[model samples]
Target chain A: MTPAIAVRGLVKRYGRRTVVDNVDLTVMPGRVCGFLGPNGSGKTTTLRLICGLLTPDGGSGTCLGEDLIAGRAAIKRQTGYMTQKFGLYEDLSIRENLEFAGDVHGIADLRARVDAALDRLGLAARQHQLAGALSGGWKQRLALAACVLHAPRLLLLDEPTAGVDPKARRDFWDEIHALAATGITVLVSTHYMDEAERCHEIAYIAYGKLLARGSAAEVIAASGLVAWVATGEGADRLAIRLRDAPGVTAAAAFGASLHVCGPDQAALAAAIAPLRGAPGIVWQEAPATLEDVFIHLMRQVPDNAGQG
Target chain B: MRGTLRRMRAIIRKEVLQLRRDRLTFAMMFGLPIMQLVMFGYAIDNDPKALPTALLAADHGTMPRAIVAALGNTGYFAISHSVTSEAEADALLQRGEVQFVVTIPADFTRRVIRHERAQIAVEADATDPTTTGNALAAVEPAVARALARELTGPLAGLAPRAGPVEVVLHRRYNPEGSTRDNVVPGLLAVILTMTMVMMTALAVTREYERGTMENLLAMPIRPIEVMLGKIAPYIAIGSVQVAVVLVAAKLLFDVPMIGSLALLSAATLLFITVNLAIGFTFSTVARNQLQAMQMSFFFLMPSILLSGFAFPFRGMPGWAQLVGEALPATHFLRVVRAVMLKGAGLADIAAELAALLLLLGLVGALALARYRVTLD
Candidate 1:
């Protein structure tokens, strides 16, 4: 079967500056695709284009087997988009907001659907509470419940867990995976590296350019970055010296240890060999972690790489 | 279309419930009309009586006494002062203590006996044109009666021909009119028009500013459906305001509806729809609620001034009258005053009804076309 969402040379411009430059992407059903990008990148804009919220300036794509331009209304019918902000009525109760969403979708038996949504999201106990009174975690859950209440074919979430707690973020991701297991395509944009790692595949973008795209292991392997993890009394002092030295592109402190990454293996070894013999410091070569490779990739791109 | 209907119904239900929760908006919606009705009803009085005036009689004789008694009996002016000199009356006028100063000349009895035309100097403050006009008119009958009675009695043989002065109270439309009777009914339109336009204009724009409109627009709904949904509840509220204002008019100011109540309600309903449509159009275009409110006020100030609520529509200049005709409030107020006071029928009010309906259609279409369903 064709991929659930397939697009080629997609371009969206705002005035003279292109917000989403020429790009190609394909995602199959039942896969959780994490779109990672720095601030002002085109991840949200690309998602909006696919979800029919915006019309692209150039390109042709098929979303859910419909033409992206001509069939936007049809695509919107089966797509659920969760915005960054909490967009429900604060003066209304949880049950009322859910029912309102259900009615907006024109679902028959709206009360039953709302009740089922409440139960599925574990929100039954707080059904009568006003949406404004709910905690951040509960509000996140409510937003997710409203998004999925119609049983959409694809879900687009933009920074869904930016301010949410760690435990709540984990639970939200777990629910997302469960939804994907049922063949619902999920396109989620997030700032969290851990959340990106949890996805089946990831696309990293910066300055409106897609720099890297693949599974975490594939991206790390493709980056070809070698790293060494070091710990000791003077790791901070050592990190400061190693940052300016040759073959070291990214030098970061992870907790008490220093993670030094570079692309050239021979040069990396020669550069760190002197540091291993330094006093009050221990150094050893290690597999470059996703974050280590991720940082290395970000540093490699020129400052204006995505300007065109 | 069916989905749009469902969504609009849901939006209407939610908005109505939210309005019920906000106590301040609720109070303003219901209380403003009654307060304005009562305040304006009591404060407005067109035909003023018992104006205080001073008297300066040079001769303490029967003729002076007759003149004072005649002025007092007219009930239009009260003799608040009996001065010995013209200087005293001038002092009263300068101090603003008296609106009018009446001076009877020292040769008052001699002039009448000689059958000559004696003129009494009636000095009055013209700052308040209405009071000055009334006071000026009242002097005629009082002086005339005093002259006629004196000539027919003790000065009958001395004066051969003596005629009374004429006092004509010029009232244009509402002759023999009570001010409450005219103003209370006119205020019904003013109060409802102001609040209704403001409330409806802010309704949708507020949702847009609060970000709740994203949830509303994300649904599979058409723009017209959203517009209707937002305006329907405000229309219902406006009807209740109409009823309250009309009832207050009847009870407090004794305002009678010479025309059919059904006609008034029908015209008011149409006007409310037009006003709400204009507001919703403004809401759709405004970036924020504050801008929407400012736009509403911009529309409101001119509408109130030119709509003939406080000022006379016919008295306005040609360009001003044309501008007034452009406002929906102008036509609606005309319909209201005609139906409520003149007992005008459908045949008499077809032109105004047509104007309001045309405005409603234009605004409704414009609102739908301008309203965007997505953030883009």
Candidate 2:
């Protein structure tokens, strides 16, 4: 499949500080690419640069075979971007919002298109309700409806389900997958590990750098991390005691058990050897989970975002 | 009470620092008042002089010539054009090229020398009550004493009301000197300026403040497209306002309309667009709706004061007249009043029309240049 987006060496600097530095990204057509990053890790900036809402300080490429800088209008025409905040007019009705989106794209047969969008979102019954009055989940659905109104070839969603409930997030993911199945490329930024796991591929960015990019299992295996779980009558209490120990990257209590991970197996074992013999406690080596690797990756990237 | 005072002092300190940090706000605070003071001090004047007048002298004798010269010496009338016929003089007044036309009849010296109550007609464009009121009063006295020194021997008695010489004052266009006649036409420009600029400014600023601008810009629309779209609605609103004010002027205030309606409408549209463009430029520069509102109000204060709407245009000091000339409303006021009261044609008010067009072009270009194509 041809690439829907191909951009290299993207550099965005704000004054003396580089917000997005020497980044490269490409996602094949019809792929659901999940972007996982900590706060202010340039995910939103990168998405904006691709969609032509912002100009990159350096680097160039094509979006949908059109030059990113010169063909910005064409890129914007075929791209759907959902902002982190609800960007739809709150004063307008749901139907009105969709109609306005259609109008912005100069869509003919506006009423019919709006009707179809409303029906797809099951918002026909409350299409007359003001968008601001909708619940968080419904608002999210309305925003999604607006985003897909023009049948864009690519979608850039920035934390689309940040504050949504679990059921709503599941529903949103189901809708996203449905769109992906229809051969529309999607690039969604999220902080949720479960959401990240749902993507066809994952890209992890931290403090303006793309650190890891691959499938979930591949990312975990490539991190070279070791984790051990301890379960006993009172094993979880040892998490606090092991947190400050040398060679241990993270130690946290998971329910009545303790989950701990470190970079090297021997150092991890030595750090927990004394605790391993605790009364009635059993220590078992477990494959490190996706969250464990992500936490470990974040611990390695030095935070230079606060300076200059 | 003491605790409350301490808390209030803390808030004051915080507010002062915030005020100091906002450099633009600080500059405008000190700059606006001082600018207003200098503008008002240099430009505002109650006594207007050098009123453009047209001379149509048919009398060949010394008495009429002496009187015309005295009229010029009084510093009230500046004879800018000379006419041989009444039709030529009439055209000058209708075009609003001159405020008054002074006619010395062919029989003036003959009637005066025969002591037959010789009359001199000074027809004033009385649409502006203040401008013409003083000049008209000065005319009779000024002209009566015109040849006082030249009147020697038996002619001395002719100058001191010993013999009859009548000064026929014809206040044309508006004979009753209705303030509404002047104000109604001027309100067409003033009302449009106030509403169109502020409304368009708020509309753009609201989009930015609500974060909708990013969504709009992320689409395929250009900055010019956005500006035109934002201004289109206000154009309709401005038209409706013009209609309402026009109807009121005609029915309630009994204001006369002597000029071409189509011409007035065309000029009104141009004036409305100019103000809208100015407002749009303000929106791009302003960071928030409050700043937009303040900028609009700041612009309006000078617009209303210096546009010859509240005061006479020629009455203003030279500097104020320059500022007035810079504002669209000033030229618009001239166009509207000229067309409505004097029956000025396109040729008559070409200067005002050109000024408005120039303003529209300058402001429209500035708005497009300031409008950001990308968020960066």
- Measured against the true structure, the TM-scores of the candidates, in listed sequence, are 0.92, 0.77
- Pairs of residues clashing in candidate 1: none
CAPRI grade of model 2: incorrect
On TM-score, the leading prediction is 1
Please give the lDDT score for candidate 1. 0.82
State each model's TM-score restricted to chain B.
0.89, 0.59
What DockQ values do the models have? 0.63, 0.21
- Residues A1-308, candidate 2: write the lDDT tens digits: 66998999998989988888888999999999999989999999999999998899999988998999999989988999999888887867788678667766767687888998888889899998878899999888899889888899999999999999999999999999999999999999999999999999999988888999888989988999999999988999999999989989889888899999998999999999988778899999988888888888888989978785
TM-score for chain A, candidates 1 onward in order: 0.94, 0.98
lDDT of 1 by residue, A215-286 (tens): 999999998989988998868666788897899977878778898989999998888888687787878888
Give the clashing pairs for model 2.
B43-B317, B43-B320
Candidate 1 DockQ score?
A: 0.63
User: Worst ten-residue run, lDDT, model 1 chain B?
Assistant: B154-163
Steric clashes per prediction: 0, 2
Error of 2 at A216 (Å): 1.3
